[model samples]
Structure formats: C-alpha cells, structure tokens
Target: MFFVDTIELAGLGNRSYLAGGAHTAVAVDPPRDLDQVIAAAVRRGVRISHVVETHIHNDYVSGGLELARVTGAAYLVPAAADVSFERIAVHDGDRVEVDAGLALRAIATPGHTPHHTSYALEEAGAAVAVFTGGSLLLGSVGRPDLVEPRLTERLARAQHTSAHRLAEELPDETAVLPTHGFGSFCSSGQAEGDHTTIGKEKAGNPALVREVDTFVAELLAGLEDVPAYYAHMGPANAVGPARIDLTPPAVADADAIAARLAAGEWVVDLRGRVAFAEGHVAGSFNFEAEGKVATYLAWLIPWGKPVTLLAESPDQLAAAQRELVRVGIDRPAAAAVGGPASWVRDGETPVSFPRATFTDLAKHLGDDVVVLDVRRDSERAGRHIAGSVHIPIHQLHKRLDDVPAGEVWVHCASGMRAAIAASLLDAAGRAVVAIDDPFAAAVEAGLTAVPR
Candidate 1:
C-alpha cells in the first residue's frame, strides 16, 4: 500500500505532502521547503514527475519552480489562473499521469481563485485520492478573495458552487489531502491544529454545510484581511520562471553589504517592521514578513541586481534565500554575514530608536507635543486619539507643510513606519519625535477634542 508523508511547516503552520513514490513522486503545494521536497523524492528513489500548486498560493512563496528545477518535472497551473510561467496549464477533466494506473486528474475548482483546481488520483479511472489545494482545506474552504475582493455576492456564488461540486462529484473513501493546514491564513475554520478528512469536512466545514446563499454570505463575512502586497503578486505568478531550488547564496559581511547598498543595490531588512523601525541599516527598504514576501520584494525592489539581506540569524539566511528564489530574485551582491554585530562593530552608523514606554510617552505629551497620526484613513477612523492630525504615511513627503510644525510627534499603530517617516522628516529639518503610543501621549497632554 502506498502511503503519504505529511510534513507540517511548523513555523508557517501550513502542510505539504510527498505522496505515492518509489519510481515516481508528486509534490503537492510545496510549502516553502524546496530542499525537503527534493530530499523526499531522492530518498524514495523517485523522479518528481510533477510539481502541483493547489492554487496560486498566498501564505508563502510557491516552490513549484524549485521542485521542477531539481527533478526535471512538469510544473502545472490551472488554465484560467492569471499566471505567466512556463507551466503545463490544465483545465477540467485533464490528466497528468505519474505512472501506470496512477494518474492525477485536474478538476477545475474555481472559487478560492478563478483558476483554482483540485486533483483526483485514480487507479484505472476509479478515484482513490484527492489533493484539495486551497479549495478545500482539512476542515475549511479556501477564501475566495485572492482574485475577487471583499467576498462579494459573485464570490459567494462561486464558492458555494465549487463546494457543491466537490461534495457531489467526489467519492467518500477517496483519501483527502489538503494544501493548507490549521494555521494557514487560507482557512479561519480549520479543525483545531489538525487536518480534516474530506468525508469529515463535508460533515462539518461551515462553508460546505450551509445552503448556496448562506454559504457565500458566511464565507464573505468571516474572512480576515489578506495582506496588501498580494494584490500585485497573484498576477505576476501566472507567468512561470526557471525552477527555484533554494541552494543558499554566497554570504558577505556587513561592510560588503553596505557597499552594495551604496552602489544602488536594494537592501531588504528581513526583520519585523517594529525591529527595523527601532533600528536598521540606514537607507535600506523595510520588507517585513508575511504572505507575498518574495512577490513584493520582486515587485518593489529591482531584480537581476544584487540584494543583500539584514537577517535575524544564521538560520534565517536560508529562509531569506528561499524568499528571494520564490519570485526569482536569487543573486545577492552581498549581505550581513555575522548578523548585526559586525555592522555595529564597524561603526557604519546605526539607526537609533528612541521608542518610549507608555509612561515615557505620557511624559512627552505634557511638553507641548503635536500628535501626527500617519496611518490609513480606516486605521485613523477606527480608534485614534482625539486632536491628532491625520497625515497618512505615504503622503507625509508632500504634506509636511500641512502638519502642525512645533515639536511634532509622529505615530502609526506600531512605531516603525512612523519612525521611517519621522527620519525622513527630520532630514528635511523638522523637529519630530516618533511616538509609539499616540493615544496615551495625546491623553497625557490634556489635549481636548470631542467626538464628531
């Protein structure tokens, strides 16, 4: 009996699988582990026949190209998905055979994405297994907002229709394998940290349980915000790249990294925005972690040029390499080799953080501080301190004259983006303090403005 190996991505909390191998293997929605997928294929003495993406992935950079690179395998995407890679695009009822009597059929499952497809493996055209990518997670359905926005009525209509097709067309005994796991943002209703059976999913997954109208309504209403960068990433992925196997890039020390930055090479600080805000290599662009990391890095930063990283640790260099490869940004000019210490030791001018605790913030507010709220309008409207000036971060460059000028205190929800803005402002000859807690600082100053 052939068995499946489910490797949980502990950090990202998604699941990837190496299913049915000896002579041939197929990697299913590889979750940021190109080496692991290659190793599994090699260990089983199998040629990775195909690398399948469950959908246009949002959680991590897709490793379809990486797997295909290592094994000389075919990378396949859905026919209608707006992707641009050299992939075998298959539609409904199309089949890719791995071996005799072991073929995967692409069943067009368009809801989570317009081009989303699920696969069914059959021995002699009798289905034995199903790889439900994002369309069906263990105990949840994929959110339909990757291509569509805000889970509109059309999105609900599509989702409910997709679910109905899965529930009706598939067999009960078919082994259910999903691309996303408990912690993947693709699902909000997955079983508590465990994969769900398709039969069990049909019984319990909320998106599957409700009638068509209600199902769409529930799916639309419950989903949290998908990250902003994905708005650009999904379309770019439609075109394929040369496969990306994350062989680590050559490392360079802090001085080399600085030289690269000086030569107009983009320096991507892989730290959290808060950490980067507190201190970072000055003039480096801050691209924080989350879904669409590589996509955004590829989009925002210049490609084919050098990209040095300000990583968290030695272990994280591999992660940074993987992120770069996901969107085909593989080459680095130089990077921080011994972490941040070498840079501090070199005295290359550190970015200092003057972040204050709530008490420290309160003390400063009493000294005639002008509060600068530099968040989006939605963020500002939700829960902002009264009497704070509404100058969004993006517009801070042009609207400096609009902001009340004496001893200005700039703040965002957290302090990083605000700090960056404040630094830019400081260079422009403004007296600014980057405030971590704008609301508390505002109240402490006895600033008064009644709610509108």
Candidate 2:
C-alpha cells in the first residue's frame, strides 16, 4: 500500500511531501517548520523512516535535519551538497529500501541547483512517483540562476536537459511532484496546476517542447530578480539551520514597542490593509498577515535586526510567525496581539492613511501628485499607467529618497503591493495615497495605459 500526500505551503508557493509504503514513509523538501510533516505522519499511522532533500533549497530553509533528528529517520541529502553535518550522502543511481515493499532511487537532475537531484519512489518494481523538486515543474522547468552568476546560463541548459531526461526515463503514469516553482519566485515561470504527471510535463512543458538552445535563451531572458534573502538561504542550509522555535515571542507593551521604535527596530503590523490604513501605531508597517509576509518581509527586513510582530489576534500572530520561520526568520524579538485602541489607551496616538481607488487618483492626475508604480518589471512591461514612476516594490525600501518630493500616489497591479508600499512610505513619513483597486478597473477608469 503506497501513499503520497502533499503539504502545501501557500505563502511560499511551495509543497513538501510524504510518500512511502503503508508502514514507513519518507519526507521530502520540508520547510523549516516540521510539525506539519509530523502531523501527516501521525495521521497516516506510519513512521517517517527517511528525510530526503532534492537539493539544498534557496527559497526556504530545509527542515530535513531537524525532522530526521526528531523522527530518528536517516537524513539522506545529495552527495554534492557541501554541508558540515553527518548523514547518508546519496548519489545518482543510489537506492534505499525504506521497508519490505518500498524503495527510492536518486536521479541526478541538476538544474535548479548545481547538485540538485530528483527521487523515484518504487513500489515493488514499479515506479510509483518521482519527486521532481525544482527540476521539472507542471508547466515549466526550474530556473537555474539561483546559484552564482557565472553558472546561470550553464545551469539553464542543464535544466532543459534534465526535464527531457526525466520525461524520457519515467513512465507517463508516474506522478510528478515538485517542491518549488509552482508560483514561487524560485522558478523562471509559474506552473499551471498543483500536481502533474511525467507524461503531462513531457507533452506540455515549454522546456521539453522547445529546442535546447532556444529554451536556454528564453529561460535566461525570462529570469526576474531573485529575492534579496536568497543569498542567506544556501549558507544557512549548508551550515545546518537552527531548530525552529515556535514559542510565542515575549509580549511587548506600548512603552516597550515605542522604545524599540526609537531604537530603529522593525515593528510589523500584520492586519488587514483597510484596517491598517484606517489607523495603526505611528511607526509600524502593515504587511497584512494573509499575504506573502514570508517573501516580502524577509526581503525587506534588515538582516539580524530586532523585529516586533503586531497583529489583531493570537491566531494572526501565530500564522505570521509560521510564515516568517519558513524563510529562516525565527523568534521575533517581541510580539503583541491587539488593535489600535489598545495602543491608544497607553497614551499613544495612531495615524491613518487614505486608500483611494484608481478612479480617484485619475481625478488628481494633473495635480501635484506623482503616480508611483511599484509592480514588477515584467508586470509593468505589459501595461502600466502613463507618466508613472517605476520602482518595483522589493527595491522601494532602499530607494526611498528617490521618490519625488510631493504628495505621491502609489499602486501595483492590485491593491496588495500598493498597501505594502503605502505602509513603507508612511513609515518613512512620506505623504502617500494608496490606490486600492484592480488594474482592469483602472484601465476602464480612463487611466492612460502605455507599454514599456
């Protein structure tokens, strides 16, 4: 009885897996938070016998070490990974028998990372599935530029080859499960669905459909800016990441938060965009706990800085903490769950910002307000408001001084990035109006659209 289960980490747009025979299982490419994997194992009534990684991940911290430690499972990592730890070093063609009827064979599929590998789960003698990791995604191959700049082009070529190899070697019915490149920035392109088969990828994946040279050229051209936090991931994983601490951080009262603010530490507000805009602590930046707090907050926060989490409820704070730890941001310096009224009662005044619609901004187009576009370069390249200043939201923190002096109107394709940018600019004490509406509505509102 072979089984496969997917553990979706929505915020990071990645998935980990549990696959094995009825009595024993293997966990693949898990996030730093290990409880979910443990829960799945408990639910399945099986012991997690092996913890394997397809590669040393660049998008999030790997929980393989901690998971293996806690479960007493054998930690199987690619032989090529340069790590200072003890475990089974697996290479291509290496096979491990998990139990009587289940076995896993490592397949060398080096594209997403230099040492990246995929694993094939075999039930008896038949292939049950292939954990493709970052190699072959549902609709596209993993981007190879996560490593050094010199290796990106070479790795792109390898990615194309790897996808073809997996398609050629694996049966059509073999399940294809990948860890990254679904909607994650780790990949050059987005995958269409949650799950895929080897035959489906072989027939529809663009990398497999195109010539090697053409695939390489297009992949390189399509590569966007990697998150700034990616540089820390490889190093952290190589040296063994610290065990995740899910304990709620110490609660900070108003005076403590204010003191941290005066010391220039970060105080992130994980509330709704509208609620945050209506009123929030003067210095806290709103990240909306439901959004991509993992990617955005990890990208923006200064490394090793004291961070304080502020949310409207204990669940929101815990959820934010879970997302944060995925990207190696563990144990915030302090946290508090309350609303604006709680802070106000402590003799602190909350501030409010206006979240305007695109139609409202169009009315002031000719005024002294500067329209700031904070969407990605690829998004803005398709269609954007005419005469808008372009600065991708990820780079906005460093380029704060570059914003023109005036009342600034900010927006992204949707309201999310606009809200994030609004919080940032507001924290910097800039007069900002967040345009909270859909881009299609903006087009219908008579805002001039221009191509890049």
Candidate 3:
C-alpha cells in the first residue's frame, strides 16, 4: 500500500507531499524548512529515495537540494529549468523506480513557468496520483504572469493545454495534488476546495472546460499585483537556496532597538494586533506572529533591509523566524522577547493607537478624519467607504506622503492589514485608528459606497 503525507506550509499557503510504498518514498516540492519533511519520513519508516520539484518556485525557497543531500536521495528537477546546481534532470516520459511496486513518471505541464512539470506516482504500473505542481489546481491554474509579461498570454494558453492533457491522459480516479493553490498568490484565481481529483478538475476547472483563447484571455485579465518580494524568489531558487538557520538571533536591548529604529531598520513586533495596538515601541511596525508574517512583511519591507523582531515570548519569536526564513528573509538582524515595556527606553512611554469598528467610523465620518482603505486594487474595485482614500498596503510605505493629512482611519478585508497600516502611520507620526473589524460589518453599518 502506498501512503501520501502532506506537509502544509500554511504561512506561504502551499503544500508539499511525501509518498511511496512500504520502504522508500519520493518528496514533491518540499519547502525550505526540511525538518517537517524529514520528521514525516522518519515516522513513516521510509527512506527518502527522491526529492523532486515541479518547477523553480517563485514564492518560497525549495529545500529539495538540501533534503536530498541530507538523506542521500537523488535530487530531481525539470530538465528545462536553468538551474546552477547538478541534479537528476527530469524530462517528460522519464520514469524512476521509487520502490519494488512504485514508480514516478514525469509529465511536462508548463504554464506556471517555462520549465514546469508534473509527476505521476504509479503503483504496480497503475497511476494512483499526480503531483500537478502549479499547472492544474482546484477550479484554477497557476498564474502565468510571474515569469515575464511578454510570455504571460503564451503561458496561459499552455496552461489550458496542460490541464486538458492531464485529464486526457490520467484515470478519473487519479488524485490531483497541486502545490500552488490553497491561498497562494501563485494561483490564477481563488481555488475551490480542500481536495479534488482529475475527474473533478475535468468537470469544473476553467482550464479544462474553457477554450484555449478564452482561458488565456481571462487568466491574463485577472492577474493581480505580484508580490514585490517574488522578484527575488525565482533567482534565489535557481542558484540553489542555502540551508536555512533557525537559531534565535542576537537579543536586542532597548537601546539597540531604539538605535535600529532611528537608523530606519524595521523593528517588527510579532504580537497579536490587539496587543500591538495597546502598546508598542515608538517607530516599530507590527506583523503578528500568528498572521501571514512572511507574505505581508516580505511584500512591504524594502528588500535587503536589516530587520529586528520583537515578540511577546521566546516561542513567538522562534515561530516567526521559521515563517520568515521560508520566503528567504533568512536570519533576522536581532530579536527581542517580552512586552512593549521591555522594548522602550528608560522613562519613555510606549506608543499606542485606538482600534475601532466600521460602526465607529460611521459615527465619526467627517472632513476632520481621513478614511484609508489599504486593501488590494481588486478588493477596492468591489466597494469601499465613501470618500475613503485608496492605497494598497504594499504600496503604503512608498506612497505615505500621498495620503491626505488628517486623522487616518485604516481598514482592510479583515483587521490584520489595517493594524499593519495603522502601525506604519503611527510610526510616521500620524494620528491613526485601526478598524479591527470585518468589512461585512461596514456593509451592515451602511458605511460602504460603490466605486464610481
């Protein structure tokens, strides 16, 4: 019997897989953090015989090279990927024996990238599962625009063809396990559900159902702003990512924290938004340890800028470190654990801001206040508060001066982003209030107006 184990990189919103027969297994699209994959193999009592990637990932670093090295497994990468490292270059129709009764066959499924490929795991010569890296996802396919603007439409057409080829070639029962959906920005659109098969995709996936031209056109039109940090991920993966170091960084004292802040280094507080709003070091930013730390922080911060982290506990600091490293933030310059009190200089009061709901905003709607919508351009297209200034959070740091001078009330789909914007505003010496409530509440309170 063959068993497949999922390793969810929830922070980055992707999944890796480990599967094989009784003795040996193959790892698919492993994340930079190899401990989880290594531990899963140990528990299953399976030696990792192969570590493979469907493509050079653009969202997070891959641990395939290092994992294969540690386990003495063969590292497999697409033959077309222009990677610097040596590995088992996989090609379409190439099959590798994984165990006595199991084998992996590579299938070219380009679209997510020029070199993207999928692997079908066959048990006793019958295909049981296909790891469709970025090609065929639930209800959606991987976004093709990540590679280059000139090739986006071409890739989209290829994606459509690839999805159909999978459906045509595989059995209806063949499990369709994808790596890039599940809240990943790599997905072309919102993915449908938790699980799906080749049959399910054939029945419902736009890539499979729609004509090539329609699918390509729609996919191109729907592409959103690529995360700023994504420009670095592909190159980093191509060069072969260095093994990550998760050891706790040097502890930053109050003086060091203050100095770093003064020097314009980001001192990020890794606490809940509410805790951060109550009290935080002056000039520090808030990226909650529990939230999408890697996605948001990496998106907003200037690349290569030194960062100092502040967490409420040692564990919180450690957890945040792991999330940041996956996206290639590597080691933090410094980290401090404890409350705002420990981070502030002697005799200096911690900075704080008020948090309210949309109902509160409705009550205070006036010229004296500037309502800021920090959601993405796509989100703001639906509806937003009347007269609210729209500036997506990712662009906020660069466009801070463009915001009208007034007491700012910031909001997003949920409050996490609002809190992040609020902190940025607070750090910039602007009086800000974070709307720590859902956008649906804004609609309930009659505070939203359709965009003109």
Best TM-score among the predictions, by candidate number: 3
Q: In candidate 3, which residue pairs clash? A: none
When 1 and 2 are scored with TM-score, the better candidate is 2
lDDT (Cα, tens digit) per residue for candidate 2, span 1-452: 88898999989989999987778999999888999999999999999999999999898999999999999999999999999999899999999987788899999999899899999998887787999899988788888988889999999988888888888888899999998876799878887767789888878788899999988988888888999999999999999999888889999988888888999999999998999999998878889899898899998888888899999999999999999988989889998888877754365589999989988987898897999999998888888888889999999999999899999899998898899999999999999999899888778987867763
Ranking by TM-score: 3, 2, 1
Model 3 lDDT per residue over 1-452, tens place: 99999999888889999998889999999998899999999999999999999999999989998999999999999999999999999999999999898999999999999999999999999899999999999899999989998998889988998998899999999999999899899998777778999999889899988888888888888888999999999999999999888999998999999999989899999999999999999999999889899999999999999999999999999899999998989999999998999888899989899999999998899658999999988899898888899999999999999999999999999999999999999999999999999999999999988877
Residue-wise lDDT of candidate 1 within 142-255, one digit each (tens)? Answer: 777766565456655776677667778877667777776565556545446454455776887766787877777676766665544455445445554345555556666666
**Global fold similarity of model 2 (TM-score):** 0.98
Candidate 3 stretches greater than 4 Å from native: none
lDDT at 100, model 3? 92
Worst 10 residues of 2 by lDDT: 340-349
Residue ranges of candidate 2 with Cα displaced over 4 Å: 344-347, 448-452
- Candidate-wise lDDT, in order: 0.66, 0.89, 0.93
User: What's the TM-score of each model vs. the native?
Assistant: 0.68, 0.98, 0.99
